[model samples]
Target: MSGRIVVGVDGSEPALKALKWAAAQAALTGDSLEVVTSWEYPASWSTMMPGVPTEFDPEQLAKEILNASLEKALDPATAAAARRTVVGGNPAQALVDTAKGATLLVVGDRGYSGFKAAVLGSVSTNVTQHAPCPVVVVRGESAAS
Candidate 1:
């Protein structure tokens, strides 16, 4: 691998699966793995949750999600070696941009597809479509299972 393996991570089962897979890939290829997560508040935040800052922080939540997923999904060694990235923005676009010089971009095929997801599209699909490097959508436990 020429560059890092950048993997999108959220507090979801599929995202955990992607993280595990990406960790394995990084281990085999001798590349560093980057665990990334992004979150955005509601568009009408001012009118919605007037106490936005005191109520919640998007960047902090993203960091928590990334850290939780890293601890839960990967082994101690892998989790310790991987870097964490937390940002506030569209998950898909954030991941795509992070893949600038990455060897590969990995994301999970979300199991839940709600109305908002249907409208905005999936992060995995968007990254696959926009990533400068190869993208892997981890759909299941194993490729040959």
Candidate 2:
């Protein structure tokens, strides 16, 4: 069977870096690239009160974020040769689940973070530990240097 490469994207700079690397790798290996993004509503946002429907829909938000991130990460030429996917759930869980059938899973070392001290983000670290396939964590440009 042909190889499949999956990359998790969230529109962050590190994610963009991962996407670029994944795209190039996919092109070189003739593997299909699947770009994935996960979105979830914060507990605080959903706990506004009883009887109030959560205005936030995780699936819809994920789709929007994935579309925007894909547009920014892949150029016309590169994207034309790849497939895109967006899933809704915890980023780590989503990535691990997607990796179940993938040849490799790629992710940024760090994603949208509230603190600079955080390393590899939670999702990246989790995937590296439990992914079904090989996992590649692309560090930030500064870290790469």
Candidate 3:
């Protein structure tokens, strides 16, 4: 049955790979693509040094990252065809929630941070365990090649 294919994009190389993979899969399955990104204030934000300008907008940054990731991952027509969402919360939880009722959920093996030898990022690991639908964690070029 045709449904949404949700993918998390964080402006990282691995995320870009996952986006591309998800787009191709959606094309084959006739599923619509939903590109998602999330943002949350740092725990230390409230405790930052006094006089530090606190004009940062995590949600806006998340939107920008999602837009850039879509451009890098898909052609203009394909990117425009996909739905984009920017949420405010933990990345893993956002992805899992967005994947509900979706045909599949796609993520990168790793995100912005993690040990070089780690097989999967925290978000990818969490979503795989909790997502309501099937999950695809695309590995880096090494694994793809």
Candidate 4:
């Protein structure tokens, strides 16, 4: 089954590593890579004293972030293997949902973490557990190197 591989990306280093890994995998397998990013309006900003003109648009933000991330992830020489997608929602949910039709789902082990954890981030852990297809969580400096 030669289907597209979906990768979850943010601006984090780990996400970039995952994207690079996915790109190589796509090139090796002759499959397309779908880079996905999720964005959402922070609840604090969206609910400023019961709707006081929230100037945040989650969809637009997602699109912009996804585009930027994809451009950074894709190489001009390997453009044929890359595609981009933006989904506005919880990051874990978006990756899991997109994983349904993908041959594989690739994600970062940790992303923009505030606290140190021994394991993967909540989003990566959740996607690994719930994704419909095979999931790969890229981590460590070696992956990037």
Candidate 5:
């Protein structure tokens, strides 16, 4: 392995931390850095309420989120140096597939703010269990701590 350093980001604080850490690691190891983000088609096509946003563009949204994550998390030079990929699929699967030939796969220990106890089945967990390369998970401190 030790080819590329792959990181999965979804714009969360923990994810941003992972991205920054991965970029640093890549610089130290002289490995290429690849940041990945995944998106899926909307699950529901139900009529949208007036205030709800219904214009769906999964690819575009994924790219924006990924870029924003990098820009917000890493220094400008670091963010610009890291290659980004926005793919359409399950986040876990996409990350795993993208990191297939990578030396290390990095992801956040936490994700989506929608649920309180959804950490176990998240992208980090899935990638840790199934990624072809070694995985590193970065977790943010609890707010209550």
Candidate 6:
């Protein structure tokens, strides 16, 4: 309400929905929207198979995902108005850090089953507990389809 709204997107269906929801909220509240995506190298990257391509750029991939998500989630004007950020770190932590001064932090429900979620941990759950601002876990289908 008083500050910007931050949303985390990962190019997933639910993440696209979250972006749409956050954009709508930002419009209603007259707040700026900041869209964020993060990338991190895998733990096994240093010991990967020989056939694996070494040309993969996680940061570039993240940027592409963010741009594509914005285009898919919002209208051209809205997408242009929204701020885009690509970070390098854990998804949940990157979101929390970027949302430090935000009025709200929005994320999607990845739809991980209860048992799987407990074992793997959910980014939405982690950010809801750790973010400095109020968090919204948008749960729904993608608007694109």
Number of colliding residue pairs in model 5: 0
Better of 1 and 2 by lDDT: 2
TM-score, per-candidate, Cα-based? 0.84, 0.85, 0.92, 0.82, 0.87, 0.86
Per-residue lDDT of candidate 5, residues 76-99 (tens digit) = 988888898988889999999998
Candidate 1 similarity to native, TM-score? 0.84
Q: What is the C-alpha RMSD of each candidate to the true structure, in Å?
A: 3.8, 3.1, 2.2, 3.6, 2.4, 3.9
lDDT at 135 for candidate 1? 89
Give the lowest summed-lDDT range of ten residues in model 6.
112-121
Those runs of model 1 whose alpha carbons end farther than 4 Å from true positions after fitting are: 46-53, 111-121, 140-145
Residue-wise lDDT of candidate 3 within 1-145, one digit each (tens)?
Answer: 6999999999999999999999999999999999999998867886864565678677888989999999888999999999999999999999999998999999998888957676788999999999999999999657556
Q: After best superposition, candidate 2 residue 141: deviation in angstroms?
A: 3.7
**Regions of model 6 farther than 4 Å from truth:** 46-50, 111-121, 141-145
Q: Which runs in model 3 stand beyond 4 Å of their true positions?
A: 46-52, 143-145
What digit string (tens of lDDT, one per residue) describes model 6 on residues 36-121? Answer: 99999878885864566789788998999999999988999999999999999999999999999899999987733344324223
Worst 10 residues of 5 by lDDT: 44-53
Error of 4 at 126 (Å): 0.4
Candidate of highest TM-score: 3
lDDT of 2 by residue, 99-126 (tens): 7889899999988787657776888889
Highest lDDT scorer: 3
**Candidate 2 vs 3: which has more lDDT:** 3
Question: Ranking by TM-score, best first?
Answer: 3, 5, 6, 2, 1, 4
Quote the lDDT for 109 in model 6. 79
Question: In model 2, where do residues sit more than 4 Å from their true spots?
Answer: 46-56, 143-145
lDDT tens readout by residue for model 4, 1-145: 5789999988788898888899899878887888888886567764554664566566776777666666676677664446777887899999999888889999998888775545788899999889999999998444335
Model 5 misplacement above 4 A: 47-54, 118-121
